[model samples]
Target chain A: MVNREFTVENDPRILFGKRLAKIRKELGWTQEGLAIESGIARSYLSGIERGKRNIALINIYKLAQTLKIPVKELVDI
Target chain B: MVNREFTVENDPRILFGKRLAKIRKELGWTQEGLAIESGIARSYLSGIERGKRNIALINIYKLAQTLKIPVKELVDI
Candidate 1:
């Protein structure tokens, strides 16, 4: 049986996507705004937000910088 | 002109490599120890430490877990 909690807790992509969407919404920025600020394509950001992409460390740093949050805020579940 | 400081500051790989090396040493763990604990190949860990690899989020998460540091500790410059 799959340990759902463990799965949820350990999946960085899901954690990142959820945090990214929440933070973006909290900041009232659209995907386009965030993408432009982070220097990633909007479609790519969309994929990341949906947990469909395996984000690179550089992009994670860019998003953290652009969102003005510690990268911890996004990754520490 | 190349903003050397800015380049150094924003390069996550370099920052990560330095921090990883520092933390690993602080914990008295060798690269082999860290690689085995983090489930990454020793060769790949070496590559990452040299900043020649674009580490993925999963690997960063794995390293953070094995190191007992927040993922931010790895990615934040």
Candidate 2:
């Protein structure tokens, strides 16, 4: 048995995912809506929310811009 | 020319690089010192400080941890 999926709850990626989900939900945004508005692929956005993507800085910036928040707010964790 | 390198002065990667350099320099740490301490490659760290890399979240967190600062401080730019 191989444990290829190494994501843990305390992982930064996981924490980032959870944070993103909470903020998006608070904004009443569906994953689909955010993807469309942020010009990210829906599947990619889903992956990001699931902590499966090692997202880049530019993408993070784009997401923050789309949500009208500071990059600091999105990544403060 | 294809202009493959699209980096500009105002690019987030550039801003991130400048911010990282400023913080690291203020700490009186050399790039090689920070890279070794943070477990990042010196060359890669150099690129990051030059705004040539679109750094990932985990790496950003690692750099901040090495600097004893909040992740937000490294990324608030």
Candidate 3:
């Protein structure tokens, strides 16, 4: 039997997700709304915010632009 | 007994660490050299490159300046 890893607990991806969620909430935007503004798929946005995926670099800038935040804020260094 | 987390495998902090290490190596900088140039501690520079610490935002900018790279390149996001 093989044990597979499936959780994102304490992942740095969670940091990005948390930042994304926080910015979206601050803007009074839903996941779908942010997706539309970012020109990314809603499902992908949801996955990103849930820390289910390691988002690409380009997407990070797009999301930051849509959220009206600096890229550094989202990255948190 | 408490199970303290002791690993940073797949941590996004590792991403920053890796980028820092890469940049430093490209410039042929030793950890001590980078610390001297960035005005940070050598031990701290080692720790940051090892992904053993979550660096502060200001320090990130300092490291970027020392490396002569854009902050976005270090972020990869």
Interface-residue RMSD per candidate?
Answer: 1.9, 0.7, 8.8
Q: Candidate 2 on B11-43: residue-level lDDT in tens?
A: 788889999999999989999999999989999
lDDT of 2 by residue, A1-77 (tens): 22243348556777788889999999999999999999899999888888878788988988998899989899977
Model 3 misplaced regions, further than 4 Å: A1-9, B1-73
Give RMSD to native, each candidate: 4.1, 3.1, 13.0
Question: C-alpha displacement of A50 in model 2, angstroms?
Answer: 1.1
Candidate 3 residues B1-77, lDDT tens each?
12132235535456568878988899898888889988899998887887666675446656777888766667762
Per-chain TM-score of candidate 3, chain B: 0.81
Q: Pairing residues by index, what is the TM-score of model 3?
A: 0.50
TM-score (all chains, Cα) for each model: 0.84, 0.89, 0.50
Clash numbers, per candidate: 0, 0, 0
Which stretch of 10 consecutive residues in model 2 chain A shows the poorest summed lDDT? Answer: A1-10
Each candidate's fnat: 0.84, 0.95, 0.09
Pairs with steric clashes in candidate 1: none
* Candidate 2 ranges with C-alpha deviation above 4 Å: A1-9, B1-9
* DockQ, candidate no. 2: 0.86
Q: Candidate 1 residues B4-74, lDDT tens each?
A: 32466557777778877888899888999999988899999998887767788888888888988888766
Q: Judging by lDDT, tell me the better candidate of 2 and 3.
A: 2
Candidate 1 positional error at B25, Å: 1.1
Candidate 1 local lDDT, A30-76, one digit each (tens): 99999998889999999898777779877887888898987767665
